[model samples]
Target: MRSAAPAPRVIAVVGPTAAGKSDLGVFLAQQLGGEVVNADSMQLYRGMDIGTAKLTLGERGGVPHHLLDIWDVTEPANVATYQQLARAEIDRLLAQGRTPVLVGGSGLYVRGAIDVLEFPGTDPEVRARLEGELEEHGPGALHARLAAADPEAARAILPGNGRRIVRALEVIEITGRPFTANLPSHESVYDTVQIGVDVGRPELDERITVRVDRMWEAGLIDEVRALEERGLREGRTASRALGYQQILDAFAGECTEGEARAETVRATKRFARRQDSWFRRDPRVHWLSGAMEDRAELPRQALALVERAVTA
Candidate 1:
């Protein structure tokens, strides 16, 4: 009797922003006859295309992509919800004998999709009080409090990220533990092969600068303006997105457009370093060079790696 073939493992293309993750994801999906499930948190929002560097339909090489633009700008990001949605898609793809390529640089979103993670319930009263504090004292003050409570969480989250700071505080209050303490250890829910796109810091910084420049050139400001009409400012998560936040500052006369552009470059570069640090901590990822000279070989190397994992 012939044994049934094992199901295809989920493939995650991950790394810092502008590290060629999207393009590599598309290539792997095309080669493996798979669909893409977005793991980029910002790319989940509608009308956040240019800043998120979302791949155009044409750029996707006729491959089916899932979970991109699934959320309204007004909706707060829920990793638990995203985990449910991503697993459903991955299960469906595997059932149909196709591969599922999970793609993005949002570390938590990626982990939520494939990791054995559980989120604590929110307490409305606690949340409200923390939110009030955030509004009154600002993110910096709350961040200092978080630093005292969970310096690890504070280090992971940006001080200016009021929404996350509030969430961390809320979680701490609800769980009676540090927010980082609530995170599960390295255990995966799915048989996932993470491919980390590796690029040198200097090169990655340059890539980010160019990518941000292209976003501005490609009418990112116009996109932000359009989304602003749809209550972007009221959308806590959307308004705090890296490029969008800087642009919002410019819109409010907080800075000149040129200053916003330069700041975006600087901020993105810093973020890329953090991203690199996050992925490097995971031992399971198979690192692949994303240099322009190595572009042609990446898909082949990635496929070979996946095949090895499948066979082993």
Candidate 2:
């Protein structure tokens, strides 16, 4: 009898926003005969196009990408679901003799996939209660409550992230276990080679500003208006998107268009800063910095590191 071949490993291309992760994924996929598996939470929702900076078919450069826009806006897409789906797809790709490259700025999603985090399953009753509390007490108040309940989890999650904070608290409330308690004990699912791209703070800030401005000009407000017209208002997943929220405020006469643009820029910058902070804490990632260096050389260096990791 023939022995089963080993499972294919993963190559994770993770970094902050505007770090050319998507472009690099495409380039590497083509170079290494691989498929790209998305790890971004926002990009998983259909019709959240502009705000998420989701890749278009053309932008994919004919490379196969998976797990993007595979869910409805109303459905909850959590890390557990992502890990299951991503692993399945990676297996399929390997069966077809292709590498799988995970690409995104979502720190939690990437870590969840690689680390095999085990989140508590959802309970409809508990979820409804959490949703009600979100409506009545507000996300901030509920987040504070979670902070008191699970300080470590609260510290790990962003306080401003209503969806995650609420979900974390709901898991604790429903399962009678802390959110962190459900996670696996430092065991990684994949033998991954992590390539983290970095740029100078000033350069990254400039890139963010430019990207936000381009997005605004690309009818991001129009997209937000369309989503709102479709009844995706505040408290909905679609509305919580960075650019969408700012534009929604403008649509409600809460801010001027210019004010909305500025807010979007500022929020994106802050998000990128948080991403940088999160990735830096991981010593496993090999950091690449400096915009003055050749951009194409970045992927080459990453590929070399990954190839070495796989062989070693």
Candidate 3:
């Protein structure tokens, strides 16, 4: 009898913002006969298009994309929920003998989808206490406390991200262990090959500037205005997104529109650096140059890497 063929492998496209991960993901999905599952946290919110650089239907090139625009702007981000949704899509695609291309710059969401990771259960009382402290003293104060308790977790989470800080503290309280200690080792639940789009800092910075400019020109202010009407300001996660936060400040008369635009560019650059650092620490990702000169070859190189990983 003939030997059975190996199971289909999942593909993940990851990198900093403006590294061309989205287009590359579409190309891979088309080439591999797969569907795209979004991993970007911001893109999960509905009506967050231009700021998130979410792809249009035409840009998707007829390849089905999953998990995009699935949440309302008022809803808070929940990676644990995302993990469940992403895995369901991946398993559905796999069951049909098709590859599932997971793509985004959100490092934890990507890992949650494919890794053997377990999120710690939440305690309402603990969460309420931490949230109360966050409201009373601000995220920086709580972040300082977290740094004292779990330096590594504090390093991974941004100081301004109160929700994450609260979650970390809650986990520490519940488990009586460091938050980082609860993270799973580098073990995967699925056979996945992660392709990281690589671009130098200089080029990446320029790309982010241009991308932010384009977002402004494409009516990001209007998008924020629409979402604001839908309680975007009430959403903890959505309200704090890079461009949206800056624009919202402008709307509140805290800054001029031009200042908001400039700040958005700067903030996006900082976020890109953080994203690069996060993905660089992962040993399993295969890096491919996303330089403008090499753009034509990126998909081909990525496909070759996937083939090598699958066969090896």
Candidate 4:
């Protein structure tokens, strides 16, 4: 027999992109006899490696990572599905007395995995119709419609994010409620030690540009081409992934390759800013500098907080 109370600790490494969350997560997991449970929504898609900055097996440093590479690039992401899978993995790890190091910059995914949140039920018919409208009319049209239906949700979701726009529209159709109404205010499903890796704007911008360049150097175009054959263009969620979206646009003759690269840098910086803003809203998060000069000490500091969370 088990009590309803959850196990005492889950360490969440959250923040803007390029803030050293992944390496810090590996360090904490190694130290705590834990596995990394991915919270990044994009990393769920298979073959989205370089662009999403998904760690290579070698980079994982022998610690296991869960909830990664679990979906095909053509599959639309469902956060509710992710929540169920993540909780399963977390509970399994806890049963074995192993920590779950939840890592990534995806704010809603993090909430879905560890918060007392309820998602509005989805209807395939409504979702399919909305998605069809999105494909035909483009995100701008759907986004404008979403704005009219739920201005708050429209403000929160980017206009170019067709997949999310479709989702918002679908929820509105199915529930006849504002999309933001389903979002969590604040209740946790786990005893969490939430760490937010902070970085200065200048440094974070530079980091994002460098990372995008490295992704280009690491064969991101080739990766995209490969995935395209796997129906990546049809995959609503995966097709619109930051770098992938831009590159796919280039392939579709919407822009030049150079323009794609530049847009990727620009969009990633914007996304990072959004990620930072989202995590910053959670007062439970303990902030730590993820600057290059301070990264070496992050692991030790984060571990101390996890210990504190255990005792407190």
**Reference-based TM-score of each model:** 0.95, 0.90, 0.96, 0.93
**Predicted model with the maximum TM-score:** 3
What does the lDDT read for residue 261 in candidate 1? 94
Clashing pairs in 1: none
lDDT of 1: 0.89
lDDT values, one for every candidate: 0.89, 0.81, 0.92, 0.89
lDDT of 3 by residue, 144-196 (tens): 99999999999999998889999999999999999999876779999888999
Q: How would you encode candidate 4's per-residue C-alpha lDDT over 1-312 as one tens digit per residue?
A: 211223247989999999999999998888888899999999999889999999999999999999999998878788899999999999999989988999999899999999999888878888888878887888999999999999999999989887778878888888889999988877999888899999999999999999999999999999999999999998878888899999999999999999999999998999899999999889999999888898788877777767766767
Assess candidate 1 and give its TM-score to the true structure: 0.95
Per-candidate RMSD vs. true structure? 2.9, 4.1, 2.9, 3.9
Ranking by lDDT: 3, 4, 1, 2
Compared with the true structure, what per-residue lDDT tens digits does model 1 show for residues 1-312?
111333257999999999889888887787777889999999999999999999898999898999988999999989999989999999999888888999999898899889989999898888899989988989999999999999999999999888889999999888889999877668988888899999999888889889999999999999999999999988979988888989999999999999999999999998889898999999989999988889788877877888778888
Report model 2's TM-score to 2 decimal places.
0.90
lDDT: which is higher, 3 or 4?
A: 3
Better of 1 and 4 by TM-score: 1
Error of 3 at 304 (Å): 1.2
Q: Name the best candidate (by lDDT).
A: 3
Reference-based TM-score, model 3: 0.96
